[model samples]
Target: MTENQILQVLDKYAKDYNFPVLDNYNFDLAQCRLSVFRDDNEWIIVFEIVGVNPSLYISNDIYAYGNSVESQGLIIGLDDIVSLPNEEDLFDDEGNFLITPFHLDLIINSEPLIIKPTEGEYLELGIQTELFNPTKLIRYLSSKYKEKFWLEPLDLLNEINMSEDFKLFYQTDEWEHTDEEKPSENKFFQSLAKAIVLNDKNLIQFKKANTHWSNWTWSDFEKQEED
Candidate 1:
């Protein structure tokens, strides 16, 4: 939809429904008055509609020790909302909205990387023990070796034989260990996932990095193994 159309829909919703307050929401209606922000490099629509209250401020103009100011505000990120066309009557399905090829085309055109699982390699072993999915493992090693490449995780998993106990141990301890070690690459991917899911613009850096990694050479892939 056009930006104007999107704004109109939001305005209509504000008038029709009482805006519900979300807990721990960090949007600033004033700052987002009519603009979008990049949260991890992804583009996100943010704005102050009506209803919700903005955070409070305390100010004392010379005389009093402290005075408070109250204002009602709303901050909404694109991730927090969904858009749909308006339908007049349910029984009369004349202008009912339908998914269009354009939507699918857009997704296909964007072509985000797909995380794959290795064959024969247990899921527990790859993500748990290796702390990397197929794409992630390749990306990790590529950077270490200063090369560019892509591969399916399922294919890699199929090549390795992992014992049951080893798989179990990795599954139980990987997340806990990751929290303590805070691997930069894993953290970066996790943040990127959140940005994509939320449509947060802030994650653009990681997205670019991912795009660059998609074109690595075979020699680069070999270097990653050494790392």
Candidate 2:
């Protein structure tokens, strides 16, 4: 249906069923919002509710199925049929989730490094390990490499984006019924995976030099002064 027609349906629902209509929203890129819109074929109206958290959000959709113009009266005969999720089902009880795509895309060494949470599933419930935290990765690299690491940032990016295991980990994090055992959480695996990919001769050299210097005591400085 057209936007005007959608608005009219919303207005009718508000008047007849006392349904609240929230059309305009200014998202902060750190919060989630519910969406109600017609399907691509205009045969169904879909209502999507997003459960938000600090790192991400979880979403579930309900449909008012049938053609709007059909005798089915899907849009006209609107009812407040709602199914609420249990408190445990919510991704973020504090409600600090982000639904929009992050604006942290980078072009490092001519390769694109994007931070996209795989759909809405991998973003929450510990499926996303620390390696998936793009900001943290950036901060760590910037401080450790003096901004020189961006020349080869794709190593870390690929580690995050190219892993089939990472995707499967999320896809199977929650299962309704299964004979196999659930996957155990691997908190350090993400960091280890990234380190395996990003470690190079330069980083090794830097680490060695830093470690050597870090071992110097005040007596070592005094010895140097005497020498």
Candidate 3:
């Protein structure tokens, strides 16, 4: 149907659904579909709208949009989406990357640094590592690994221009204050960075110590591990 026709149908449901709109005549739709069905032998018209948010009534729209909609079938699939080559500079004239580094954080939280009691080491600043502190989480997660750094993990954080917060997690047993062999500083950051950027992991691909692939997430070794 034409955009006007679809707009009319959404308008018809507008009052009943109270979809977030600037006015009575307007609604946002990036994409939409109209479905017709027989329910209890009566025809029902369904409007599926992929709405874009450009307003303050987002919370109302989020739950309200789906409230009046019902399902016939649901399908979700994933495929590699090809990104077109762009000659556009990724950085500004100031030499800073145009893209921003997004940090994932949560409400203040802490998790214990798993240490063997035999070592008798403790932090006076609370025995548990602050999981919310990126550096401590990095170190704590690193302590769980047994691999040695192929690329000095601490150095990797600096070389890649990671923030100062990440620079403190040393990839060594001494940092952990335990005799147990240190986990790979290299793999620890690699794994952590990989996890942090799982959606855009390729955005900062680096050839680290143990891995040969630049993608890091998928390789013969990684695939084998997953299998």
Candidate 4:
């Protein structure tokens, strides 16, 4: 949508629902806000959206973000969250929790609205061997983000242009990512694709018997002796 149009939607939502937003917004103030009401859905995921150019990956055809999050973005008072996470468990402590700011995104086009973390999101928070507070927090948000999208009957696509001018706060091309293609290449996708064609149908396979060390267990003389 045009910047103006996107702002209008965010403006509408800011009025329609109350989602947790950053108190530490470091960039120029958000051009606008996007929101989702507390719901029982488990879909507000955390993952990187931007990366080095071209190697860049995205879920929707596009995404929208603001300035660099290192100097920016993040958190809730926590106790006020409307969904399922217990308030007592969210208390901030000096240890066992890394209460840092967050970077976020608004997924337009696909679902009615999805507020995902572009940075500082730890998806494995609840499942890790150590139960991190970030995990609990993310899980809580994800669950709350689970409302079905408002795409079809709403015909949101025609109404929104997503704008050509928005910029990413950041993408972890230098960091990690979730499960998908290029197992080894998932982190820095370009590194692997540059080294070898990942999606190539003629991908080469290696067999130990074809290497010079393949003869380490025996020699011609040993074969002759066997004969």
Candidate 5:
């Protein structure tokens, strides 16, 4: 079928299903392609945009361009898709590789939501580490990471970035505390910075120390006498 014909079908579904229009949703029919299907009750639309967001939207026609290519019955049975090139196969022209640092996951009321943070987020994190002020850092981070009743975990980080209050807080300096009082503050901040950059376990250790969420402490590491 022609692109126009496929679009007409999608338009019908958009009206019937009330699929939301994505922000700045525009695509070129010649360059990009899509696949559409319904899994259970939800509509899934997958995009194949080169060097851009490869997304699967739920009940959204924003990327639903056409009917997916029909699968032919396999001539030879294969247990895995290892024949196809994966994202790991991609590399730069200069041969230096790019890697995804971390993916955020959350279980909200028993449903799992996962998302990868944008490159801009990593840049912002680097700036935050550079401008680190130990005394106000916790309060600053708390204001950003505070619980939101309405937000899905995927939306929370974006919401934090959008907040005008956070922008002001990020820009201002209010460090009045002495280094003597919190001697370990710099080291703690360093660990936190390293954790953010490397997406390591150091962040958890730092949070446990600072927040006192559990009763765990240095004393917990005390070696018990061998029986």
Candidate 6:
């Protein structure tokens, strides 16, 4: 059918449905192309609009001509669309139907954080050795330190630049606080204490002390006391 012929068909439907034709275009999907007829296509067409703040409405269908049969289908408003028709035949479809546009009323806005387990392991050890409680460490660093430094897990790993020895310390329990070992003498324990007292979020400098150590030096103990 010609473009003019298609437009005539769409006009008839628009009048019957009391819908005004806004615009039309051709859509392509996969390897196929089809014509899209629209009546307010400029308006955002949201298919699921129940929970949406401002609902959207779509008023067109996609149509493609085949050798034996002409196929027509509604364009669903979602991420999974594969093809759209060309600009010409959009109004050539035989019928006019009103379809609810997909509505994604994304109300909550939040940034996503990607955490790696390997990086998390190192970070957990670094914080623990510094004498901060694990839970408190994650919370404080995530809120305070991370906010200021904008340090993500990968950023933390890159900053530390630990050697194989430090990596091994993280692998082993050299920094973990045990019942038998008091928090005062242990370097890891003291670091945790200092981190807690001073509220330090500098994971880069903190990971510098990743080593197999039985105790902290007098200076380290003094730092915690002053903090």
**Candidate 4: which stretches are off by over 4 Å?**
1-79, 82-89, 92-129, 140-145, 148-227
Clashes of 5: 0
- How many clashes (backbone N, Cα, C below 3 Å) per candidate? 26, 2, 2, 8, 0, 29
lDDT of all predictions: 0.24, 0.25, 0.25, 0.24, 0.26, 0.24
Q: For candidate 5, what's the RMSD?
A: 24.4
What TM-score does each of the candidates earn?
A: 0.15, 0.19, 0.18, 0.18, 0.18, 0.16
User: Which ten residues in a row are the worst by lDDT in model 3?
Assistant: 75-84
Model 5, residue 130: C-alpha shift (Å): 16
Backbone steric clashes in candidate 4, count: 8
Badly placed stretches (over 4 Å) of model 6 are 18-74, 79-227
TM-score of 1: 0.15
Candidate closer to the true structure by lDDT (higher is better), 2 or 6: 2
Query: Which is the leading candidate under TM-score?
Result: 2
Worst 10 residues of 5 by lDDT: 166-175
lDDT of 6 by residue, 1-227 (tens): 32233333333334443221111112111111111112211101011100000111111122211111122122222321111222122112553222111211111112323332333553544433233321222232333222321222232222233111211111111223222333243444344333323334232123343222213222222233477
lDDT of 5 by residue, 117-169 (tens): 55455455332333222111222222334221122222322322222221110
Model 6: residue 217 alpha-carbon error in angstroms: 71
Task: Kindly list the per-residue Cα lDDT of model 2 for residues 61-174, writing each as its tens digit.
Answer: 121222343321122211111111222221246653222333334443334445553433334322233323322223222322333321122232132232222111111111
lDDT of 2: 0.25
lDDT (C-alpha) at residue 164 in model 3: 27
What global local distance difference test value does model 3 have? Answer: 0.25
Which stretch of 10 consecutive residues in model 6 shows the poorest summed lDDT? 43-52
